[model samples]
Target: MGLLAGCWSAAATAQALDAPNVVVIGPNLVTSGQPTAQALARLSQQGFEAVIYLAPSSVPDAVGTEPEVVAQQGLEFIHLPVPFGSPTEGHFESFAAALQRLKGRKVLVHCQVNMRASTMVFLYRVIFEKESPASAWESVTRVWSPEGPWKRLALSQMVKHGIKFDPF
Candidate 1:
């Protein structure tokens, strides 16, 4: 009875939460939804060797503590607070660098709501992960609409990185 209840609870959790794209592109590349202690723990259990944060500065405490916890779990943690629409070359470059560093290691990159985080992940995959433009656009559109300023910036940055996905 207890085992059945646990299974039911897990199923409910999966259904209740927003279904962010959780994909395993390679031996170590994985993506998922928002960040939390339990989420990090699950990532750790699933071989996520690093946690990359792109959350807003206002909610630093909630997302910032993930690094410490990840360390304790014997995984690395890296935080990159990439505000929407103003992502610098340095930020993008550093993020790219981080992704390179975590190559061959399971990495879970996320934000508070996973919108910005997903965009960043899509850009990284498109540019650095060698994912095709079609795949990248599909991956990003799964979580973000191609409308609005934030999406505009995201598409433009992809172009800057030599990804030729159509904006509309």
Candidate 2:
């Protein structure tokens, strides 16, 4: 009976970890794809205190009224608007600053498909949180492998921050 109970507990934990469009990166942070209003409500129910959006409002899939929806759900909303074609260091800095300020708070950082969110979170974890580069890269790659300009941006930023990781 004890062994059966342990299996049940593990299954339950796996289910919680498999929330659609959401990835639990650490104790205080979660990354996600574009979330719907229902998803935001669910996040609130799950105790996420803040939501940081990296995608711009002009994006076709973005929820234009997300700020109001997030406010209604009682979650703080921040928009940094990093372009998919060309993410800048300034954008990274803003994201880092916001993440730093929100340290210890339950925060969700999201982009259109978790690409930007995961990369930004990877950099934050490696540089600011002093996490291992390989470990942080694992989380980032789990979403989407960065490429082209995005790849360049990530690599350059990592170099600037003195983070070293072998290309996977």
lDDT per residue for candidate 1 within 42-140, as digits (tens), equals 655665678777766466446446667778889887878876656666776788888898888767676665666666677787787688867666656
Q: How large is the C-alpha RMSD of every model relative to the true structure?
A: 6.2, 3.9
Clashes of each: 0, 0
The TM-score between candidate 1 and the true structure equals 0.74
lDDT by residue (1-168, candidate 2, tens digit) is 487775664444324533335666755688878877567656666667888999998987787788987888788889999999989889999999998998888888988889989889988888898998887888777778889878887888889988777564
TM-score of each: 0.74, 0.86
Candidate 1, run of 10 with poorest lDDT? 16-25
Model 2 earns a TM-score of 0.86
